[model samples]
Target: MIIAVIDGMGGGIGGQIVNYLRQELPSYFEIYGLGTNSAATSVMLKNHANKGATGENAIVVSVKKANAIIGPLSIIIPNGMMGEVTDKMAAAVCDADAFKILLPISPENFELVGLENKPLMLLIKDAIDLLKKEFNIK
Candidate 1:
């Protein structure tokens, strides 16, 4: 399956997700890192994503072929990630055919309801667990 990890800014959260997924998932599963900028893409690529692309167009085009999409919840909000994630990118990701696994990592002025303030690692683990459940992986 093709899994896409999307992120912006420093790409720290996305990098962690890619690293965990690379360690946990089988080699056959392809991980695509989509970033709002080259810096984010670089971080994810370093974490072992098979391929990576940057900018709104790259994200929009890649999401079409993704089996699953993982990233911060802010990725879906227009102008999120301090304006790194554009409206077009948010629209494409939300409308993609992939199953979205969004972390509850809130950006400034955006918060998810009923979610406790957990560590980033824990939130990422939840995302990984969701992937395992969706793919029926042990």
Candidate 2:
């Protein structure tokens, strides 16, 4: 399966997700690091993403080939990630046919109510768990 992990800014979150997923998921699953910038893509690649690409166009094209996509909820929000995510990037991700696993974490301007404010690592773990269940892994 092809899994795409998208991120922006420092790419810390995306790197962590890629690291954890690489450790937990089967090696057969291909992980693509789709970042809003080169720094972000580099981080994910260092964390073991099988492939890496950056910028809006890369994101727009890669998501189409992904079997699943995981990232912060901001990925679908226009101008999210401190304005790193563009409208086209967000629209492409939202419109992709792949299954999405978005963390509830949002930008400062947006508040996602009714959900506990968990740590970043926990949120990632929860997302990975959900993906595992969806694919019948384990």
- By TM-score, the best candidate is 2
Off by more than 4 A, model 1: none
Cα-based lDDT at residue 22, candidate 2? 96
TM-score of 2: 0.98
Clashing pairs in 2: none
Per-model TM against the reference:
0.97, 0.98
- Clashes counted in candidate 2 amount to 0
Report the lDDT tens digits of candidate 2 across residue range 1-138: 999999999999999999999999999999999999999999999999999999999999999999999999999999898899999999999999999999998798888889998999999999999999999999
- lDDT by residue (57-85, candidate 1, tens digit) is 99999999999999998889998998998
Runs in model 2 lying further than 4 Å from the true structure:
none
